[model samples]
Target: MPDAVVVEGLSKRYGAVEAVRGVSFTVGHGEIFALLGPNGAGKTTTLEILEGFRTRDAGRVEVLGRDPGDRAEGRALRERIGLVLQDIAVEPYLTVRETIARDAGYYPSPRDVDEVIRLVGLAGQERRKVKALSGGQKRRLDLALGVIGDPSLLFLDEPTTGFDPSARRSAWQNVRDLRDAGTTIVLTTHYMDEAQALADRVAVISDGEIVAEGTPSTIGGRDIARARIRFALPDGCSVAELPVAGLPVDAVPAEAVPGDGLVTVETRKPTEALHELTGWALRHGMVLDRLTVDRPSLEDVYLRLTEHGAPEHNTRRSTR
Candidate 1:
């Protein structure tokens, strides 16, 4: 599929400091791509450059297949791209429907204000003043304004930052609806779970470069990361006394479990270990209390990538 956004060898600098250096990636059509990085890692710098809010120091960038740096082209691109910033400035006196309708006027062809308000779950509250809405409601209003223009691409920066669990989940469903309708989205969030849930693929940036890029499940070699199988120890028993062999597995040595009163098996082959362990327990009539298979989550891989800083080359793969 052709990319909706493309960047290569992108660089940006602020006087003596290099904010972004040699970062490159692509967002596929109708896909949700996330950019994640620790503070000062240049995630925003990269996004700003693509948005044409800042010019790149060096490298190529294309938004909707045209150079975003071109003033005339950029003006046209703005109509196709929607931005929901972290903070929204609005007249507290304006009602929900009024706010969206005002922003809709900027586009060549805007969506119906009523439909956008409904899509954003602000149906009954349309007449309520912006100042009267809750924090979550305000965020939804921001989302409505962003999509009111019916943009082909949407930029969501921490869309659910202050939302509660219920509000956050509601926001996730709205984002999914946009994707289903074929809107390419570029998201940036500090929430690892949000990135995993929404992004078709994610890129981790650090030290002004991309350190890893792949599906949320496999980035940073997470698929091959060792899994820790844990179970509570039976009374009066030591980890050594637990079954170690005589099955189709090479058990991780007992000492590696790392804690007392609970047995942990760290293995690269969790499937086989789990099968052998369960069989042994059944034969001995033992109950494996609190058994859990733990593997590397996106958060784990993200921490590892950021802490180590960027490598010579990013481990990038095709986006699903």
Candidate 2:
């Protein structure tokens, strides 16, 4: 089957700034694709272009097998696309059911309002006015309306932005269910864990261009198995005096001092380093305490990609 969405050398620019620069990627049918970046990274601009709300300055885009910039074609293509925006402003007096029913009218064929309500876990709140719902409930109502059309492609922009932990989990479950039912979902989120949990592929955009694109585990080439290890030192032993045989000298602080009667070390190879350090401490009659190992996360990858200009691999693309 052809891709659900495809772009080639896509670019978009405003008067003084380029909002999107030569960004290209494909979303396979039924795949959950995530676009992740900090604020002002052009994620929204890229999504807006694909959604036909904005036009590209250059390049080509095919969404649902139709050119998004063509109005007639775009309207037809939109029937198969659902959009859940980050901010939803609905009439405060409208009930949840009324809100969804109103949106369902726009699509030729829409899922049953009752089913959408159930799917989003808003069964009991169906009669509640929009103004009466909590923040999380309001978000769910937005999601319910977004999917009511039974769109094959769903655009979820920060779907769970204001949700608490439990509500976020509930929203994740709904997204997973949609994917299982063969919905092609394009998501934009600042929450790394959400991307890691829901996205089959992720593209990191910064300064109007794609800086990196890959699976959440491998984006920016992060090694998931590698860990950073830090440990506190014991009393009477200078950090410098701690035998640093196997540890990288630079990994240890130059002016390491006793903190709560312990020294600390950071290492990429935690398992090997910990074993060696433990053995050395045992041999030297010292105990290693407060040891902790942490793995690099998607947040780390996002920071690395955006903190600098485009990464080395992304340098070939022109910024403007």
Candidate 3:
């Protein structure tokens, strides 16, 4: 299938500092592609370039098979694209229905105002003025306006920035609905879990470049490691004396030895480590209590990649 958006060696500079440096990626039709990164990581700049709001300094960009820089093409391109920007302000005097109706004028075909209001969970509030709504309601208004045109491609920049947990989840559902309806979504967000939940694929950018890209579960080679096993130790048992082969003793913290007889051990190979530990404990007439194993998460991978500093190469594939 053809790509919904394609970027090759895309770059943008601000006199001395480069905001985006040779970034390249593709968003397939009907796929949710997330640009995950921290503040000042060039996510917004990249989105703006694709939206035709900003010009790129170098590289090729194709949106819906047309160059976004061309004015005529850009207008046609805009009709197919819906944008929910990070910072948006609405006229305080305009009611929810009024706001959506006003935006619907820009497109040749727009969804019914009432349907759009309900789609964004603003049904009862449609009569309320923008200034009278809460923060979350305002965000919903932004979404209604963006999707009024029923765009095939949607760019959501921190779509649920200040939303509470429930509101965020609701917004996520709306995104999923769009994807289910064959809309291609390109999302930029700081929340790791949000990216992990909604994105089919993700690209992590740092220092004005993409540093890592992959599925959420295996990004940064995290799945290559084993699970961690934690349990309580019997009285008089020492971590050094624990007969767990292939387990790093250093990974067990000294503070983990509770007065009530608890020990936590982290291992790269949980199966073998658990077998050895269990056998050794039984032989020594000791019992392992509250044993549990856990896998690494996307947060772990993110910290490993961008915690210290940006890597040398612009991109690295996850070792799943």
Candidate 4:
């Protein structure tokens, strides 16, 4: 399938400070792509450029197929792209159904009004006025309006910012429903777990550059990062007599745990180490307490990629 979005050598600047430099990536059709970054990382600038709200200084940006820079073409393209912006303020007096029905008239092909409301978790809120809704409810209304047009592409800016945990999961399923219906989504959010749960692929931008881009599990080489194995020892158990034979002594770095009977090991090959450790414990008739294995999470990779200690890239991030 053709790419839903393609950006090449995209750069933007504000006064003396550069916001984005040579950012390039592609979003596959019907895919959920996420741009993960911290504050001032140029994420907002990039999304706005793609949405045609901000003009780019240089680059080839194609949304769906046509260039988003052409004024006449961009105007028509706007109808095909939906935007769910943060802090969207709607007319307070308008009821939920009235608000969605109004926006649905803007597009040539709009989703069913009642369906959109139900899809956005506003089914029971059909007659509620905008002013009377809670923060999370208003956010859901924002989402309803964004997708009312039945646009092929959707831009969700922190779509679940005000959602509670249960509501957030529901919102995630709603996004999945959109994707299953063949909508291409470009999401921007501060929550790593949200991205991990939804995005098919992700690009982490920092200091106006994309430092890493790949599947959430492997982003920033996380698949190769060390695994942390933790287990609490019982009374009278000693680290000296512990059984871990398969791994090299230096291959796994053992760390001291503060409690009386706790041990932690950081190793590149955790499966082998754990196998040996568990087998030894079983033979010795010892019960392992709280044994847990943790791989590098998406959050861990995100932190390391955007952290100040990362290696510097003197060369710009442009192949062209």
Candidate 5:
């Protein structure tokens, strides 16, 4: 089967400003693909082209084996895909069930109304008017409308924008369920953790170009990036006094005080470094307060990749 979506050498311009420059990627069937970038990074333009909302200046594009730009096939393509944008446009007077049921009528094979309601965590609020729903609840309603069509492909933009922690987690599970059931999803969000938890693959766009594309764990070489070891320096201990394996220790200023001696060691061998540091602390009968070993998080890599003048990153394909 053809991939769910494909774009090669895509480019877009708004007068003098080039919005998207040579962006290229593919979303496989049943894959959760994430497009990530800061504001004004051309993410919106790239998505608009794929959604057939805007035209691309140069590229080959296909969505669900059809050209989204083809007006003759627009309705057919729209039937096979769902969209949940950041805006909420439901009628205020319509009840949750009413709103969802209304949209289900647009598609030929919609999911059961009640099933979609529960899927989006609005089961108990089915009878409540849209105007009465909370901000988070309304976002859930947005999701319900998007999926009621039982689309083969779904597009989610900041899907959990107004959701609280609990609601966000529930929404994540709902999205996973959709993907597991043979749905292809294209997601865009500023939440790094969301991408890390949900995306099978991710692409980072910066300054109108794709700087990196890879799995959430390995993007920007994060899997091989040095681990950070941090600890508050013992009251009397100096950086040079520590028995590290020739690893340089940098004194990081503690948040509470300007010159407080918090230190960090960046190394690839975290396990060995931790053992040696803990052993030294044990031998001296001293405590290493707030010791922590952490690898680079998705947010860390994202910030680095999007920073001005940051080096371009390479992509690594994940084995399916």
Candidate 6:
């Protein structure tokens, strides 16, 4: 089957400012694709174009095998899609069941309203009025409404903004279930961890252009970047006393320094370095407290990729 969404050389302009410039990407069927960028970086503009809410100034864009820009096909296109936006107003006087059931009427093949409620964790609140719900509960209601139509493609814009940690995790599982059942998801969020956890692939946009795109683990060369292993310095040992001769000499520090009773080793070969370090400590009868290993995180890569005026030449479009 064709990809769920495809945009090539997409661009948009408002007044004299170009809001999006030559953005191109594809979302595979049943894949959770994340579009990430800082505010005013054209993320919303790009989404609007795809959602048929706004027209692009230039480019080829197709969503669910239909051109969202074509007015004649707009209704048909919308029928196949679902959207959970940041601000969607429901009647304050309407109960959760009434609100969801009302939206279910708009789609040709809507899911059962009660089933959607349960999916979004609002099973017990079906009788509650919309205004009576908490901020997080209301967000769950929005999710219920979004999926009530049984859409093939769902667009989630900061879907868990008001959710507590526990609620957020529950909602993440709901999204996963949708993908598993053959729904394509297009997600946009400022939470790097959310993107890392949910997205099959991610595209980072900066200054209206895609700067990098890849799986969460490999994006921005995170997979190959230096790893940092840290632990409390063993007592009675100076930084110089640690075994370092077998480690990557070029990347390993000449003098393993300790600060605040901790020593950190930066190396490209973490497995080898860690085994050597731990083995040496065991032989010396020393204990390494609070030990931890880490590589560059999604957030670390995001901040670096979105730096103002950061060159766009590093774009890593997915070849999958």
The most accurate candidate by TM-score is 5
For model 5, residues 48-117, the per-residue Cα lDDT tens digits are 7788887789989999999888898899999999998888577899999999989999999999999999
What candidate 6 gets wrong by more than 4 Å, as runs, is: 235-241, 254-262, 309-320
Worst 10 residues of 4 by lDDT: 311-320
Query: Candidate 4 local accuracy as lDDT?
Result: 0.85
Candidate 5 global Cα RMSD: 5.7
Q: What number of backbone clashes does candidate 6 have, counting pairs of residues 3 or more apart or in separate chains? A: 0
TM-score of 6: 0.91
**Candidate 3 vs 6: which has more TM-score:** 6
Query: How many pairs collide in each candidate, listed in order?
Result: 0, 3, 0, 0, 0, 0
* Model 1 agreement with the true structure over 135-242: per-residue lDDT tens digits: 889989989988998999998988997799988888999999999999999999999999999999999999898999999989998888888788887666677776
- Give all candidates' CA lDDT scores: 0.85, 0.82, 0.82, 0.85, 0.86, 0.89
Candidate 5 lands at a TM-score of 0.91
| Local error of candidate 4 at residue 231 (angstroms) | 1.8
TM-score of each: 0.90, 0.87, 0.85, 0.90, 0.91, 0.91
Model 6 gets an lDDT of: 0.89
lDDT, residue 265, candidate 6: 87
lDDT of 3 by residue, 129-153 (tens): 9999998888888888889999999
In candidate 3, which residue ranges exceed 4 Å CA deviation? 231-238, 246-264, 275-292, 308-320
Total clashing pairs in model 2? 3
TM-score comparison, 3 vs 4, better candidate: 4
Q: Quote the lDDT for 35 in model 3.
A: 88
Better of 3 and 5 by lDDT: 5
